[model samples]
Target: MQDNGPSLVCAPPAADARSGIVLGEDALTVADAARFAREPGDVPIAIGEDAALRMDASVAARDRLILMRRPIYGVTTGFGDSARFHLSPEKTTELQRNLIKYHLNGTGPSAPVDVVRAAMLVRANCLARGYSGIRRGVVELIVDCLRHGITPVIPERGSVGASGDLVPLCYLADLLMGSGTARVDGEPVPAAVALRSRGLDPVAFEAKEGLALINGTSFMSGFGVLAVHDAEGLCAVADLGTALAAEALMGNRSHFEPVIHRQKPHPGQVRSAARVRALVRGSDLCLDTPQVLEANPDVDGLGVIPLGRPIQDRYSVRCAPHVNGVLADTLDWVRRWLDIEINSTNDNPLFDFATGRVHNGGNFYGGHVGQAMDSLKLAVASVGDLLDRQLAMLVDTKFNHGLPPNLVRRVDPGDPAAGLHHGFKGMQIAASALAAEALKLTNPATAFSRSTEAHNQDKVSMGTIAARDARSVVELVTEIAAIHLLAGCQAADLRGAHLLGLGTRTGYEVIRDHVPFVDHDRRLDEDLGVVVGLIRSGALVAALRPHWDADV
Candidate 1:
């Protein structure tokens, strides 16, 4: 049913917070889902008219198959290894209810509210495609919960990414029946109470309704969407950090020159280099090749006049585009794959009205998300390592040109407290620790697939674990990027913020406003956290946006 999905990924407009977000057989962008997930007040959900028609027709097909009393997977027969067992039509509803009850085995921490909300939206979108055969009213109940801001407390763990993230999805299904816990405005409450207070009633499971709700890739896809979104932002922030570091080190700007990237011309590399160049457009501190050569020109015909400093910067400063380029390029394809996975009807026993057949298959497998997230985390961690190295160079005396050692805030040479203060040294150590942790998680989660469900599902996707790991890496790298930015801003201050490049000056001022210069040793843990907030909220990148194109 998937025809290479959408070939393009132009981000759709942000979902209107006041107006309802429309869920149908259409594309839902990362920006839109993120908006709906975190918008403070309740945002309504609307089922598209065509999607409603499709849902109606699909339910009709399910009823038609039941009339003949034929055996259909999860409809008349038992689930998993018990499929050999048969059931009467009267008992199918009971079987479905039992399905939800048995799989309430999810354990560990509750998923973040954003992940939960995004999962709910993605699941509703899948059903809106009209192949799952769920009752239209049941689907409406799910939408109403979203509209009323009642999100199920799904565990972040316990999903193997096969058989439709069974454990976590079971919790979501149970919520529909008003039997689980939900969060209202960030406070936990009984699902029954939340629904009742919002004027919604508990839904009873019908023949296929429970199975339809609990079977799909919603959990993994939700995390993937957010991870991809954050990874993109991290890449841009990394470039800004590079620009700031270049200015602080008085490094050569020739590395990001258009002609250098033009030779290779990988889209990501080209764009990444462009962003750095644009950020440092009119800077005097970062010297061009000719400027450095002119300053150290040979005075006599004797070869070898000491240039004092190296002609080029280290790899972390010079090869940043190649590193961040991989992430930017990986996102292009990952977005395409997620476009297909989220929009697909991935539940089992799909009802196809055109051929008058109820097809039972393995559409619920989440291999695509698993692989995409694994690849994404690997790239993000690499960028984190790159940013860490950049931060390392920004503070060290051997590498930071003539900047103060450890970027100490210009204490007089012989002052009693001059040698006692250490600035950003602790931040560099913290960044290294975070970078190591992020790298450790890059090992593929999909490679550790387990055999379960009585071996009825012998091979599994493990996509959910991978998506979660990717989210972890993105988060850790965000902290690393924060430290990198703080150090970059500190280094820029040492060199005089006014001398920073056009775009980097804007980034410098934004960071400096929140965190002033450290005249002496002080607790900077709070400063790290504040910059982390700036990075995640896109505030740092947004400040630089006026100087560069929005796409950067």
Candidate 2:
């Protein structure tokens, strides 16, 4: 069956040949995952010298345990409910094979190719930590799969976020053994065909290799990494969208003053204010509130003093820093946690070569990932609601400070009224609908944990579900931001975009390049697609990058 998830467009890894990442040595950052997702490539991935030695030592320990007939979990014994049923040494290899085959029951759609690739990278990183007692060949096989773009078609469901995403990860282990399906350059084919065409053969598993490969937090980590990276980009996009809307609304720039932010002393608020201030810097359209200009007579007659603007813009416009600042702060917290998670070994029964012992622990639990994702979804949904409000304000003349109703550009100036043209009328509705859906998904996924596996797998972390929800919220917000971006650009043009701030001007021009000013009532569906592509393609984010840096 064909896998229908979005195909990842391969981009080069952020690190070059000299600075490339080495498995089990260099740390993997969320940004690295983002770069790898965009451009999947064959970067150098080898077991580190020290890690390899440790791996050898670990394998020796496992062998000794097997010789002594030690009752090891998933090694010399059955799994889960059958843990008491011991396996003979001769049947260990067959037990490992059966472990993977029985868990090949993942339901639901396949994850996106980028997610699968990220999962592969994360899983390989964990194994390369020299704790899983796996052979170097197993690590090399995973690397080759990623290097060749052979993304296993793992289902989106069947993980309870405990015992480390076992069901979905089984598909990955199955693919390495050439028994499942994989996507070769986005085309689905039999895993055996994909592997053989690349001059590779299916791997034969040893006693504990299959369990080590299929157990751990790779799936959740992959989704969480992508969500965090996308959230970072979305926060920047929020700043850009709001900056343009501020220019269009002729909003008071005094609200973002450093002194006011200093009084509050929130790092995120300060950064957010500074970012917006930098974006609107050098713009003639940005006005000070009468109270602000009046209070400061030093520069009273300095700028193009606009008259009849409100004493204070609405909360959506004036309180943008507070909202987007919360987003910035949330990202800071999430990144801090993910940095540790993406690098740490999250498997069970970690073999300590130095101690010559196997340690069983709950490192496989995904509660940390779950908590981060749950909080992240709320932040993402809040931004979605913020953008939804901004989009609404841009479409209504009452709130838009004299921009045309629904932001309809006037073509025939003599027509006096362009009653037939209703611009962004339905677009605003779409934005609201998306925002509502995102908000509805904000219910904590961790609260719905279910017990399974004969009560052995009780209190499973629903971190995977939370991560998926965060990803969905990010996607929805990206759409809403696209609508607001298009409308903000149109409003900027109608209001004489020359008055826009430096960064806002660049953003406006970029939007105008792809989606022209909507002068008449026309279907904005295609325009939305163009703008969404620009946002998702990172053009909008890149355009706004300098402003944030300058502020910093």
Candidate 3:
């Protein structure tokens, strides 16, 4: 079959718009990223796109070096700890091939299929820039792999976040050389068979092609892309959850009053507060009187004095915007960093062969991505923690004001427990466990580094770990938010209140549509799965987009 065209992968707009350096466009909004998942053949790869000219210039300089007698490090000699070794013209090819083979030492479980695909796509794009002294044929081969779904089985471990994502990328290089393993039609096959099945030969590594392939932060960038994409979803979910919690608690909507956010003037805080206000708009529960005062007519309840339940709610309910606001700020910072990384030429020995200067530098270091991922993970964890606390409040009779214990089906018709039983006991436990895992993963991986390879890689970025952790935290937060959604929907259903914020009511209805109220306890995993699927599929995000867009 002819190679399919560029797929509509949904990467963020900022990350996808630029070119040259790999990683442009937000990973979340990139349409058809799976099209670039391996390497496509028909897609036109260029070096001098309007957005990537600087990188193109850098690569052109390297090509100029091959015409000169100057001994560029990887172009003419050797690489890495092997930079001192010079290769003869006949042996240069062998040197390049060996470089890829030696680096294919990654271990541990295979990375997610999407991440592996993204890594291959990024590597090919970097090569297409032409700065790496790689043959255009090599770039085409990589693209062809993407088009054909020939994803190399890259291991998740072994990258120290320095000298690029060498270890995992080595596996990718090996597959291209017909020496490693690849997934053909979703089945693991020998590299040689996989290449042969596509009627292709092993890619012959040229001068710096191996180094170029293995010597970038594609592993970290892949995770960064995936995490940032998912984080956007988590942020939206957080907004939805906060709205639900606010309505359920019957807290002051004045806290989200636009004027309150305007005074603070922080963009994220302002956005978050505004989102909360929008979600709770038209909420009858938000306007409902406290049950304690509503139930008692004569006990110190003068007709002149309006009866109210508790004077105040717990901090989790009252201070939701303050908690989720931090996450909004963190997401902004991550988005900025990801945008820069995606558009940056983060390769080593940056080929300025044009200036007769091959500057072997630490441009490939993933410290920026590392710190950003760590910060994002922590922020996400905090959101998860907040959601967990909110869910707890919903289920606990002592905390819910008048709601049933566990938000369950009550036993007696007239009794507070009549129709409700513990609706979310198992879900609450699961949410708490997910939150705890998220919290444990929040320790900044950037700070926990061990100098490896005889201290040559003394300062490690641990950026891949950070990105993976952030992705994990995003998943955990999504689950927590789903639990909150379930609880909030149940509460709203039990109360029979008509008014709900436009966005929040939509979220509640979406949840109700997927997993009906737990009138009787059945299989909880099935319900949880439905929620997870909805969140991952961006159902909730789609539901709330109009309200958020209008408010913004």
Candidate 4:
């Protein structure tokens, strides 16, 4: 649970990797953000040579719009409501600088370092395609910041998820220009000092470079990608946790039989049922025969009596697969959107200078990412709600079969408070509080919108809020799962040394490693924290992957 081993390292990238994209299948399992903050390799940033040549030829064919008289949206005019303001060629560079400086209004707590790094990576990748018309030097600055661990202090709020996450990204652009602030080697410093310390000069804005830098959905998309990736892990853990819960409860495995799954055959439901069956396969308690006795013939006739608590367990234990299976299905939907978002070109007013054409488009709207992230948060919260219910069942005497109340300590009747002690009262309370917070955070932020900046952003997508909410939900879900694991392990121990399935055994081993059984209810919050840490570090996933694969 509390692994004191060395931290997981970042393994080398595979040979067939592309520039700026860290492929997940072959990449090292990054357990912490510090691993990603280290300098990356020399991935080149190149202009689209083929597209540039075509654009050059197209520019040659157009003499009607001469260089001195030509006008471009961001190139020769102010942005948004000020688009009517035209500028001479001499003022274009100054205009770009002014654009970045004026829009730096992002406020709130800074995002986690990894998210900042991810945003940098997303922005760099978008620029690498060479459609934004920015010089290669500008893109390289973003790459350098990421490589050298000089992440700009980007606030978490103030993004409309349209018009390219303007306010939030301006904070990043401003730092690159040596005019804002950034975190250098985990210490806050002036942007100018941070850049200078790295022997890098702040980049000056060019014709369309400022607009290109700030006019994109990198903020929302980057956070969404991170949230969705973490949600996938949570979904997997939810399945594993549900299976372990079923095993601890000695619930009917018939519900997960192949025949039962074949009749309906929803993919998530079938997969969840199969996983539960595998985890309960070698469980001796699950296979134990029910005790039966014939009633006495003395009074009234005779009746057969069934024993061993009851024939069926409570719904929390019996219905876990169905509850967690829905989350698995929701994750599948979120993954599709994330895949498309990561590969999308979301900059607005795309240019084809070679063909002498420009297309203003809806690429700036973040509806896709916003909706996906909103759904992901709700799904993860639902998992937390399910886990909370299961944990309650594990601790409540009514549902715990013959186990001790709250799994507490028992002693001789003569000694009331001597050897007798209470059990997971504090832990159950913590679980309830955490579940309440998770439910409170379930209100989808994407559905709330307000016009701002003189109604220029009349219809907004609060994708940033959705992402932040999802992150909070992830923490709450991890805490709830920790409580469930602690309680389930206790329940299993109380039921005697019955052989458990591979997955449940691994989970028990994880708990035994750090927090021992609750002989007495000492401080439980500390133990819960340890379990939460283990879950967050992917220790559970690594331990259970072998068992999961063997079953399939």
Candidate 5:
């Protein structure tokens, strides 16, 4: 037999060459998960030195129970409705193996690689809490797969968010045991082959190891964390968009004044208003309603009082904070919930080594996650709907003040494409379509929850579905925001970018770097893609956030 040097499977993440996040050592934030989940290679993952010891204690506690012949769910007895069917001591391994094998019936397309990686990281973090009776070796197997850039082909569907994410996570169990499929550079390949290529062998499941592996809210919480991160960024960019729209429409700046929002003072609304003010600081484009009213006071019998511009912007421009703020507030609670869920010991029939007792409970139920994501879907779609409306007003000549129809720019009036040009017209329609789809998905997935796996598993939390739906809404809304941003940038070009504020001017330049000014009618789908990428990557928000450091 030829030697392949060291087995990548058993290599310690701590021993890896890069500085990175330590699971079980500290609380994992959404920011940490985002950095690692997107590119696992950039940030290495390591288990804390004490994490293995904790797993050892859990295993020992479980061993003492089995030695005494005491009954336990899924360990000494059958699962779900068959909890009454006790098995012989020798069948413990088979019980765990059957748990993984049967749930392999997960239906749906394989999840994206980033999602799979995030799920794996979250699951490992849960087991690291060391209440799941997982062996140190099984935890290492998961870490090894991540370190070697091998992600399982877990299905996106299945799992009722109770009894853990059993079906989808079963694929993870299969890869750990070397049976199912894994993605090798985004292409499907046999798990065994992938493992062997990395100079590793498939793990043999222990008594409660399979139950430990598949029993948690890893999939739901993992995807939830990512969605929440994007939603948060989108909130910031929405403020930036509001600033640009206010300038483009020559709308009233009084609408975003600190004194006005201070009266109502919802934390999100206050902060959003402050962010917009900071972004629009030193701008000459937006109107001051007080100045307009004072300068044009009626002199002859309450004459028409021609102030020229409208006294206030439309709701989409004026109430942007109110729309985006709801999601911002939603994230305030959602982040805390997800942090708890991911760091939780969600295992059923948990072993407490400190007290030498076994406690059975339903910690695997993801009710909090379901409600958070359901609310996230609603709040996020509202932002998209608002942006869609903003885009609507931007493209219409009647509402856009003095801007050309559809924001069409005729550099050479007689250059032949004069009336032929229809700039930003198609992008507006696409934004509307995206906003509609996003609104449709907001019909709470949790509201339609149904029973599954017999009457024993009644009242399941459809949190996984809700999380997936939230992710879809975020993606759709991101595209919608992208279109709004592109249109807002075009509006800036029409209204004179030189008149933009310090923050919006900086924002416009950054966008113009990626997408040039639309001079003529051309293929815009690619431009939309580029801008969408910028939004999701958080680069756009990063460029504009520093200017808001003091204000928000």
Candidate 6:
């Protein structure tokens, strides 16, 4: 359905929010889902009339099959092991209700409200494809729940990522019937109470409605959408971080030369090199190695500079493009895969309109998402490693060129607080600890597969867990990025602000706007928080968006 109709007034408080995205049998990109998920106000959603009509047609086909007693799966028969048991037509409603009730076994802390909302939106989109045999009224209720801020309190655990995300989805199904808990305006309450407060009614399960609502990959897809979005933002910020670190270390920009990159021509590497070049352009802090060598050549005339100030920068300073470039490429790949998954119809017994038959199969397996998330975790953790290494370099006198030890401003030796004032010493340690945690979370989710549901659902994909792990990894890495930004700015200050590149100079000023130069040691917790907020808020990335366009 084309999403161009007037939206229903689902909630007065949220009524004036952005106009709803119409859920039809069309593409719902990952970026689109992320935007809708992160909307500050409740973004309204509407069912497309064309989608409703298509769904009505599929519903009619299901009704015909039921009247013929064609013995369809999940419609006339029980689910899973009970698929062998045929049910009478009168028991169809009970069968659907029982399907949801039995699968309400999810257990863990509640998923974030945004994740829940995204999941609902994804599921609604899947149903709108008109292949799930669900009625338009059911789709409206899903949209109503999201618009009125009625998010189901879904648990974080359960589900093998095969046969759909059944456990959490059952909670969603339970909420539709007003039998579970929900969050309204960020407060937990009975689902029925929340719905009633919004002038809404609960729905009773019909023939295929229960199965249609619960049988899909919405939970995993929702997490993937947000994770991919954040990963993209992180890559941009990582570029800023690398630029700041490069300038602070007085590292040579020779490594980012196009001549060196053209030989490899990896798209991500070329892009990363370009961003670093742009970010560090016009920076006086970077070493002019060619000029230095020209002025002081070796006595043997090998075209080499004298062995002073070291011939080259350390690996952390020189190999940043190689490290961050791979991460950039990985994020781009995962985004493409998520774009396909978010728009896909991942439910079983799909109604094939052209063939006029229910094609029952395992289109719901989340192996692709599982692998993408696993790959994402590894890449994000590597970013943590890169940032950690750079932070360590910034604090140490041995590798920081001529910067003061621990990045402390050179104080009077006779001053009483000379040795006591340790600048960025504690901040570097905190960054290290966070990097360690992030690296430890790189375990692959596909390695933890388990058999469940009477062996009928054995060897299921642990994609949800993988996606959650990737989220945690992203969080830790963001903190690490914050620490790097803080330390890099401090190092830049010691080196002289006038020496910084155009983009890095602007970034340095942005950091100092919230946090001042550390003349003496002070509590850095608040400073770290402000920087992290800036990163997560996308402000830092946006400030340098022009510099990052090449990387994107």
**Highest TM-score scorer:** 1
Provide the overall lDDT of each model, using Cα atoms, as 2-decimal numbers: 0.86, 0.83, 0.72, 0.69, 0.85, 0.82
**Candidate 5 residue lDDT tens string, 347-369:** 78888877778899999888889
* Residue-pair clash count for candidate 1: 0
lDDT, candidate 1, equals 0.86
lDDT of 6 at 412: 80
**Candidate 2 segments exceeding 4 Å error:** 1-17, 290-307, 411-417
Each model's number of backbone clashes? 0, 3, 49, 1, 0, 2
| Clash-forming residue pairs, model 5 | none
Worst 10 residues of 5 by lDDT: 1-10
TM-score of candidate 5 against the unseen true structure? 0.94
Lowest-sum lDDT 10-residue window in model 3: 1-10
Q: How does each model score on TM-score?
A: 0.95, 0.92, 0.86, 0.86, 0.94, 0.93
Decide which is better by lDDT, 5 or 6.
5
lDDT of 1 by residue, 1-552 (tens): 332123311233345656667676565666667667767355667877667777887888898998889998999999989999889999988999999999998889899988888888889988887888887788888888888888899888888888978899998999999998988877899999989989999999888888898889999988988898888888889999888888888989999998999899889998999999899989988888888887776758877667765679999989999999999999999988987888788899898765568998998999999999999999999999999998888889888888888888987779888789998888899999999999999999999999998999889999999999999999999999988988888888778888888999989889989998877889998998999898888888888877879534
Q: Clashing pairs in model 6?
A: 1-24, 1-25
Candidate 5 local lDDT, residue 389: 90
**Which candidate model has the greater lDDT, 2 or 4?**
2
lDDT of 6 by residue, 1-552 (tens): 323224311211212235556676455677778878887354556766667776877787777777877778889988876788887778899998999998888898899988888899899988887778888888889888888888899998988888879889999999999998999978999999999999999999888899888888889988888888888888878888888888888777787888888898877778778888888989887766785465444668566544654546677767777877888889888988877776567887776554467778886788888899999999989988998998998888888878888899887899887898889999889999999998899989878889887887888888888888898899999999998999888888888988899888888888888999989878999998999999888888788877656644
Question: Considering lDDT, which of the candidate structures 2 and 6 is the better prediction for this target?
Answer: 2
Lowest-sum lDDT 10-residue window in model 6: 8-17
Task: For model 2, give the 10-residue run with minimal summed lDDT.
Answer: 1-10
Predicted candidate 3 versus true structure: per-residue lDDT over 181-285, tens digit per residue: 899867899989988998888878866677887888877877777777777787778878878877777666666777767887777778887888888888777
The lDDT-based order of candidates, best leading, equals: 1, 5, 2, 6, 3, 4
- At residue 210, give the lDDT of candidate 1: 87
Error of 1 at 93 (Å): 1.1
Q: How displaced is residue 482 in candidate 3, in Å?
A: 1.6
